[model samples]
Target: MDVLISGASVAGPVLAYWLRRRGFFPVVVERTPRPRLGLGGHAVDLFEPAMEVASRMGLVSALREARTESELLVLERPGRPAAELRLNAVVPAFDDDKHVEILRGELATILHGVTRDDVEYRFGDSIRTLAEDATGVDVTFESGETRRFDLVVGADGLHSRVRELVFGPESEFRHDLGGYFAVFSLPNYRRLVGKIVLHLGVNRMAAVYPVRQTKDARAVLMFRSDTTSQHDHRDVAAQRELVRKTYAGQEWELPRLLAAMDDADDFYLDTISQIRMPSWSRGRVVLVGDAGYSPGPAVGGGTTLAMVAAYVLAHALEEADGDHANAFAVYESRIRDYMRLCRDAAPRVLRNGVPRNRVHRAIAETSLRLLPRLPDRVRSRILAGGISGALSSFALPE
Candidate 1:
C-alpha cells in the first residue's frame, strides 16, 4: 500500500516510520526546507508508553542523546528568593524513567532521521490539491507532480490543508481556547538563576525558563485575546506588532522578550486553540496530531498523545489484515480515553496559570510551594496517577 503523509515534523515522520515497518510504502511531504533543529531544550513529557514506542523503534538511545536536563521550578518573581517550589517528583509507572522530557524540535528531528532511509520525503514542497475517492486519493503538489495513493493521512498541523479540502473550512473544527501564545529565544542575559519565572495576571501571563545546554532562555508570552478577528499567517510584521500591542504595559521580562522579537530568527505566534473533530478519519484519508484533535496547547500532554496515536493507528492497521477503516476506528477507540484526560486537565491548569484574578494567582503559587512538603511516596503516587490519567489507558498490541 502506498501511503502519503503530509507534514514532516512530529506526526508525519512517526507515522511513516511505523507504516514502513508494516510493509507499507510511505511518502512524506513537508513545506520546510530541511529543518535543522537542535535537541536539549524545553522539556516535553513522554509517557512510559510513548517512550516504549520509541524504544521499540530502536530510537531510545537516540532520544536519550537529546534529553534535556530537568532542574527547575517556577516562581512568582525574578530573583525574589521569597519562596521556591522544588520539582517534587516525576511520574513513571512501573519504571522510574518511564516518563521523560525532551525538546519538541529534538523529537521531530529524530523522528525524521529514523524515517529518512525508508520513506520518500519531499521537502520544500507541498500538496497543492487532493481529491479522494473510494479507490484512492489523487494529489497534485506544487512541483507539478500528480499521483494517487492507497491512503492519505494528514499530520500537517492545526491549519491542515487536507482537513479544509475534505472536511470543510478550518473554522468549523477549530475552537479557540481564548488565549494567544508566543515563544522566542532570549539570551541568558537575565542570568535567570536555575528556575522558571511566571508572573500571573487576569487573562494574561508571562514566563521564562532557561533552555538546557545553552545560556539562552526560552521566553513564552501568553494572554487571553479575542479571536473573532483573523490575521495573515505569512505576515510577520503584522504578527509582531500584534504581540507588542497585546502585551503592552505587562510586567515581567515581557518588554525584553518583545525587544528580541524584531531580530528573532524564529518566533512563533498562535492563538491557543483546540481542534475538535468528530472523526479523525474520512474514507482512506485520516488526520493525526494537531491536525485532528489538539486538546489545546501546553495544557494537555498533546505531544505525548500525538506520538502514541500514530503508533496505535499503525499497529491497528497491521493487525487488521488491511481493513484500513476498521483499523482507523480501533485507533480512535483505543486512545479516546487518554485524549479525554488531556482535554479535561485544561480548565484546572488554565485557571491556575491564567487566573481569573490576582487572588487565584497567589493561591496557585501557594500550592506550588506546598508541593515539596508532601511525602515522597505520596508525590510518586500522584505522578503515577498523572501518567495514568494522560496515557495509561491506551494498551499496545503485543
Candidate 2:
C-alpha cells in the first residue's frame, strides 16, 4: 500500500516508520522546507506508552541522552522568596519509570532519522486538495503536483489543512480553552544549567529553562484571555505584538524576555484549544494525532497521545490486513476513550497550572514548596489527582 501522511513533526514520521515496517510504502509531506531537528523547540514529555513505542523502535537511549535534563525547578514570585523543587519528584506524579522529556524538535529529528532512509519525505509542500474515491485518494499539492495514494493520513497538528479539507472548518470542531501559549528561543544569559526558572502570576505565567545540548534557553509565556478572537497562526509579527502587550510592565526578567522576543526568529504562538470530533476517518482519508484529536498543547499530554495514537493506528492497519475501513474503525475504537480523557482533563490542567487569581497563585506556590518535602507515595497520590491520572489512563494495544 502507498500511504501519504501529512505533517512530519512527530506523528507523521512515527506513523510512517511503523507503516513501512508493516510492508507499506509511506510518503510524508511537511510544510517546513527542511526537517525540524536538533535542539530547537520546546520541551515535551513522553509518558510510559509513548516511551514503549520509542523503545520498540530502538530510539529510547538516544531520546534519554537528548532529554531536557532540568534537574531543579525554581519558582520566582514578584515579592516572595523563590521556592525550589526537584524535577524528578514532580515528574512521577504524571508519568511512570518509562518517561523522558525531550525537546520537540529533537524528538522529531530522532523519529525522522529512523524513518528517512525508508520513507519518501517531501518537504516545503502540503496538500492543496484531497479527492478520495473508492480506489484511492487523489491529492494535489500546493506545489501544483498531483499524486494518488491508497490512503491519506493527516498526522498534522491542530489547524490541520487535511482536517479542513476533509472533515470541515477547524472552528466547527475546535473548542477554545480561553488561553494562549507562546514560546521562543533566546541566549542562555541566565546561565541556567540543569534548572528551570518560573514566574507564576495571576492570569499569566512565564517560564525559562536551558537546553542542555546547546547554550540557549527556551522562554515559554502563557496567558488567560476573555475573548476567543481568532489569531492568524502565520502572522508572526502580530503574535509577537500580542505577547508584548500581554506581558507589558511585567517584572522578574520579563522585560529581558520581551526584548529577546523581538530578535527571536523561531517565535510560535497559538490558541490553547482542543479538537473534538465524532469520528476521525472518512473513506480513504483518516486523521491521526493532533490533527484528529488534540486535547490541547502544553497543558494536555498531547505529545504522548500523538505518539501512542500513531503507533496504534499502524497496528490497526496491519491487523486488518490493509482493509482501511476496518483499520480506521479499530483505531478510533481503541483510542477514543483515551482521547476524550485527555480532552476532558485539559481545562483542569490549565486552571491548575496557570493561576487565575492571587489565591490560586498562592496555592500553586504552596504546593511547590510542600511537594518536595512530602513522602514519595503521598506526593504521587496528591499530584495524581489531576493531569497525571488522565495521562496514564490509556493502555496501548499489544
Candidate 3:
C-alpha cells in the first residue's frame, strides 16, 4: 500500500515508522522546509503507552538520554518565598521509569532520525487538494505535483490544513478551552539550570524552564480569556503583540522574559483548544493526533496520544487485511473512549497544573512543598489518587 501522511511533527513520523514496519510504502509531506530540530519547542511528556511504543521502536534508550531532567519545579509568587518540588517526587505511582519527558523538538528529531532512511519525506510542500474515489486518493500538492495514494492520513497538528480539506471548515471541529498559550526562547540570566520556574497572577501564568545542556531557556505564557482570540497562526508579530498586551506591566521576571522574546526567532503562540471530531476517517482519508482528536495542547498528554494513535492505526490496518473501512472502524472504536478521557482532563490539568486563584495556588504550593517529605508508600498512594490520568495505562494491539 502506498500511504501519504501529512505533517512531519511527532505523529506524522511515528505513523510513517509503523506503516513502514507493516510493509507499506509511506510518504510524509511536511510543510516546513526542513526538520525543526534546533527550533525553540516546549517540553512534552510521554506516558506509559508512548514509552512502550518507543521501546518497541528501539528508541527508548536514546530518548532516556535526551530526557529533560529538570531538578526542580519552582513556584514564584509576588512578595512571597518560592515554593519548590523535587522532580523525583513528582513521578507518579506507577513505574516511574515508564514516564519520560523531553523537549518537543528533541523527540521529533529522535522519531525522524529512525524513520528518515525508510520513508520518503517531501519537505517544503503540502497537499493542496485531496480527491478520493473508490480506488485511491488523488492528491495535488502546493508545489503543483500530483500523485495518487492508497490512503492519506492527516497527522497534522491543531489547525491542520489536511483536516480542513478533507473534513469541512475548522470551526466544525474546534472546541475552544477558554485560554491561550505562547512559547519562546530566552537567555538563562537567572542561571536556572535543570529547573522550571513558574509565576502565577490572577488570570495569567508564566513559566521558564532550562533546556538540557544549553544556556538558553524556554518561556511559556498562558492566560485565561473570555473568548478565543482569532489570529493567523503564521503571524508571529500579531501573536507576540497579543501576548505583550495581555501581560503588560507584569512583575516577577516577566519583563526579562518579554525582552528575551524579542530576540527569539522561533516564537510560537496558540489558543489552548481541543479538536473533537465525530469520525476520524472518511473514505480513503483519515486524521490522527491533534488533527483529529487533540484533547488539549501541552498539558493533555498529546504526545502519548499521538504515539498510541499511530501504533493502533498501523496495527489496525495490518489486522484488517487490506480492508480500510474495517481498519478505520476498529481504530476509531478502540481510541474513542480514551480520547474523550483525555479531552475531559484539560480543565482539571489547567487548574492544578496552573492554578487559577490565590487559594488554589496556595494549596498547590503546599502540596508540592509537602510531597518531598512524605514516605514512599504514602507518596505513591497520593500520586495514584491525585493524578490518575497521568498514570493511566493503555493496552495496544499485538
Candidate 4:
C-alpha cells in the first residue's frame, strides 16, 4: 500500500520507518525548505523506553552522541540545598542513566536519516487539500501536484492543518490551559554551569539551563499569562521583546538571561495548551503527535506517545492485512488507555504551574517537599504500567 504522511518531524518519519518495515511504501511531505536549521526547538527529556525504541530503529547511538549537553538543578527554596530535588527526582519513573536530551531538530534529522533509504521524503511541500474515499485518499499539495494514497496521516503539529481539514477548527478541539510558554536560545551570558536552575514563584516561573555550551544555551520562561497576546507565531523579534517586558524586574538569573536573548537566531513563543481531540483518526486520514493529541507543551510523555503512535499504527496495518481503516482503529484501541494517562499527566501541571493564589505556591512547595520521600520502586511500577504496553511489540513484520 502507498501511504502519504504530512509533517516530517518525530512521528512522521518513525511512522514511515515502521510502515516501510511492514512492507508498505510511505511518502512524507514536510512543510519546510530543508532540515530546520535556525528553528529553536526545545529540549526534550527522552526516556529509557523511548531510548529502547530508538535502539530498535538503530538511531540510539547518534542520539546519545549528539545529545545536547545539559545540567539539571532543581530550585525549590532559594538558599536551601536540602529543599532542592533533581527534576528526575520529581518522578522516579524514568531511569536517567539512559535518558538523554537532544535538540528536537537533531532527533528529526536522525529519524529522517534512518528512514530515508526506505521512505520518500518531500520537503518544502505540504498537503493543501485532502479528499477521502472508500478505497484511499486523494491528496493535493501546494505545488499543484496531486497524488493518491491508501491512507493519509497528519503528524504535523499542535496547530495541525490536517486536523483542521479533517476534523474542524482549532477552537473546537484545543483547551487553553491558561499558561503561556516561550523557549529561545540565549547567548550563554550568565556563564551558567550546565545545570537546570528553576526560579519558582506562585503562578510565574523561569528556568535557565545549559543547552550546549557556555557560549550557546537555551532559556525558557513560563508564566500564567493566558491573556498575553502573541502577535505573530513566526515573529522572533517581538517574542524576544515579550520575554524582556514580562519579566522586566524579575530577580534571579532571568534578567541576565534575557539580556542575551536578543542575540538568538531563533526564539519560540506559544501558549501552554492541550489539543483534546475526540478522535485522532477520521476516515482515511489520522493525526499523530502534537497534531492529534498534544497533552500540553511538555507535560507527560508526549514524545513517547508520538513514537508509540507511529509504531502502533504501522503494526496495525501489518497485522490487519493492509486495511488502513482497521489499522488506524487497532492503533487507537491499543494505545487509548496510555493516551488517556498521558493526557492526564500533562494537565497535572495546573496544580504546579498555575496558581489560584499565593496558597497554590505553598502547594507547589509541598509537592516538591514530598517528592523525595515518594517511593521510587512504586513510581517505577507506575512508569512501567504507563509506557510498557504502548511499545510492547517492537518487532517488524516478517
lDDT of 2 by residue, 1-398 (tens): 99999999999998999999999999999999999987777899888788888989998888888888888999997778888988887777233348888899999889989998989999999999998888999999999999999999999899899999999999899988999999999999999999999999888999999988888899999899876456787888888888898899988899999999999988888989899899999999999999998998898889999999999999999999979999999999999888888888889888977899999998988988898899888987876676666777677777
Q: Please give each candidate's TM-score.
A: 0.91, 0.97, 0.95, 0.86
| Model 4, total clashes | 3
Q: After superposition, how far is residue 345 of candidate 3 from its true place, in Å?
A: 1.0
Top candidate (TM-score): 2
The per-model lDDT (C-alpha) reads 0.76, 0.89, 0.84, 0.72
Clash pairs for candidate 4: 71-194, 71-195, 71-196
- Pick the winner on lDDT between candidates 3 and 4: 3
TM-score of 3: 0.95
How would you order the candidates by lDDT, starting with the best? Answer: 2, 3, 1, 4
Any runs in candidate 1 off by more than 4 Å, and if so which? 39-43, 78-81, 88-96, 192-194, 377-388
Rank candidates by TM-score, best first.
2, 3, 1, 4
Pitting candidate 1 against candidate 2, the one with the higher lDDT is: 2
Candidate 4: regions farther than 4 A off: 37-40, 68-98, 228-232, 235-238, 354-356, 366-370, 373-398
What are the per-residue Cα lDDT tens digits for candidate 4 across 338-397? 677777766655556555577887776676666666787765554455333233323322
